[model samples]
Target: MLSRAARPALRAGAAASSRAAAPAATFATLREIEGRLKSIRNIEKITKTMKIVASTKLNRAQRAMTESRSYGETSNKVYQSAETKPLEGEGKKKLVVVCSSDKGLCGGVHSGLARFIRRRAATEGDNFDLVILGEKAKAQLSRTHAKNIVLNFSGVGKDVPTFTEAQSIVDQIVQLQGDYSEVEILYNKFINATSYEPTIIEGFSEEAFANSPNFAAFEVEEGVLPNLREYTLANSLYWALAEGHACEISARRNAMDNASKNAGEMISKYQILFNRTRQAVITGELVEIITGATASADM
Candidate 1:
């Protein structure tokens, strides 16, 4: 139906048109792949940076935890030797001081503490008051235990927790209006570099200490009892805070490391897919050109 020279040109034009449509879809897919790759690369960078930062802080946090733990143990030795236990005061509730942190991205550190509190409340009939030491726990517990939250402090565990911070927090806790029979400091205890669990250290009231079965064994001044209680409370809080900070840092480092590994795996997968799609597109174009040439030669 057409002249020979015209047929070749027409076939060439048809081939060009088909290629234009086909590669449009292929190119769109390629662009999407490129965008995803770029996004994943950026995420990997951010997670790597976070991991490095967490690793750097972990050493300091662990060192502080060791010192604080020793100090706390020494403070509690008197109560232990005195055989002091929490007294069940009439109409007095127990106080739970949760040592958490403001920053997140540290796998399950805050949530574990919150879950422990919820379980304790459920089992114990919600007879305890709460004092949260960080925004993360406050946010989590506020949803379920808002009424129980008597006091909360933010901007905690930003670095190695200092005695000043713990003392200030303990002072505020002591100032709380409730008649607390005993104080329990809840925190994440580091089991190892890769494992952690929620734990508690007890702080007894002066009255409880006075009534201990072995209290007669130690000689104390009349005014020193109250001071000792307060000092031990501060030391317990400092130990909890320092250990919890170390756990958070270690957890964050591990979480970021895992995230970066996952991102790398995804990038590798997408890159393979992108390359295959590109190769298919190039092959399709070549096939179209060959088919058109064959048809033109026959015409």
Candidate 2:
């Protein structure tokens, strides 16, 4: 019922009013985007920091692993050259010493060992007792292999493991009364900076070492056999611990690096969305203002 000149004014005013409601919804969306952006930024920071820490530790761990490997191999050469083997049919159970770490965020380092033990248990039966070196493995293995755990040491692998620590652990293990035919030191073997696998270093019992087909060739002293056995056990344990620590650090660095990249990607997406939303809000406000001005002019 309005005249031609007033009709344009009324239409413009109605259009402006309709658009006025849009800012509220847009504001809510903007807030959510901002909140998400902040969270992603925080996550990126944390992951970056973790990556740095792991990188710092990786160098020292690798060095220690190298030294330990040399020492362990040297110590075991006598048994290897003597053609020693674990005595079977001796009516004794096997002992598996699991070397892992107390910490986590290392991407399957601990879980891999747990899975290996579980698979062994499933296929070979639970005839072995577990000596866990880390809480992470203990927690994972304890669910099913609780009764088989003989000794557990926590707070291990916090740093480069020393020979003294390994010797102390050996002292405790020797104190255990179980009659084990074979003592296997299970640990993560570092194949490279990026890959590792669970492996075992065999610890020959004193009887197995002495009864070797070629042991008589070495001319070892009468009382030196026991000392050699215990010394070799400690050396093997140190090697396993050092290698496992290196693998864990490498794995953690890779994991944190991936996490930081992913977080950065998320942050970029949210930032783009936030900027576009803000521009849209500004455009919307400008449109409302222009429309209102046009309506007044028409009136």
Candidate 3:
């Protein structure tokens, strides 16, 4: 319904309306972006804290693992020197222990270990049964290999994984192995601050048990070495716990770093959008003022 003379004015009004909308849109977008950035910053803070905590824990864990490794190695050497003892009866099953974290937000720490276990289960066949150490591992492994899972223990956290805890799980494994063939542990090994890899540690085979030369070289009384069996079991479990803790920290650090990078990118994008919107508003106002001034001069 606008005449020729009014058309320019109408178009200018619409442009002004659009220009007004630009600032609002920019503000809304900025708010959202800022909110996200804040959230990411918070996440980064949390992850950074976790990383530091993990680092401290990792140092302790590494020391524990290192100390335990010597015992395990010594045990292995001794077992190797000893003659293999035949299984007294028909029990012969493979037991697998899976170690993971109870908590999440550490990136692929849980999934990576779970994937490794699932792959091994597929290839290793039905002879294997699982004992899970963490809730994450329990939840994940239960999805696919529920049938193969024999026992589960949760609530392990940053504390030094004790021999008591190991004894509880090891006793079960020993009982199962007494009826089966072997026992193994699957866990993450911390290679460095930025890297972790899955590892599997296996117990001695029946043949290895029988043919080990180091076992024969031991001069201890027969029953005296029985106590050493507990030590060996505890050492192995401690190593797995230490390595798992280290992996957790490394994964958290990487995850936080990625989050921080993503936040930076988002903040930059929103800033560009705000600048463009501001420029559009200024250009619209300048055009309106110039048109009005020319009309007044002509009048």
In terms of TM-score, the best-performing candidate is: 1
Give the per-residue lDDT digits (tens) of candidate 3, residues 1-299: 76888877776668667767756775676567567657766765765676566666666766766676665566555554574443433446677788886888789888998898778767866667888888998898788989988888888754766657777777765565335555677888877777788887756544435445555566656565546665565567767877787678667667766766776676677667656766775676688679667755754
Off by over 4 Å in 3: 1-23, 83-91, 175-178, 204-228, 285-299
- Judging by lDDT against the true structure, name the best candidate: 2
Best-to-worst ranking by lDDT: 2, 1, 3
Q: After superposition, how far is residue 202 of candidate 1 from its true place, in Å?
A: 0.2
CA-lDDT, candidates in order: 0.90, 0.92, 0.69
* Alpha carbon lDDT at 277, candidate 2: 94
**TM-score, every prediction:** 0.92, 0.88, 0.76
Off by over 4 Å in 1: 1-18
**Could you tell me the lDDT of residue 122 within candidate 1?**
87
Backbone clashes for every candidate come to 0, 0, 20
Q: Global CA lDDT of candidate 3, please?
A: 0.69
lDDT of 1 by residue, 197-269 (tens): 9998999988999999998888876588988888899998999999999999999999999999999999999
Candidate 1 Cα deviation (angstroms), residue 17:
4.7
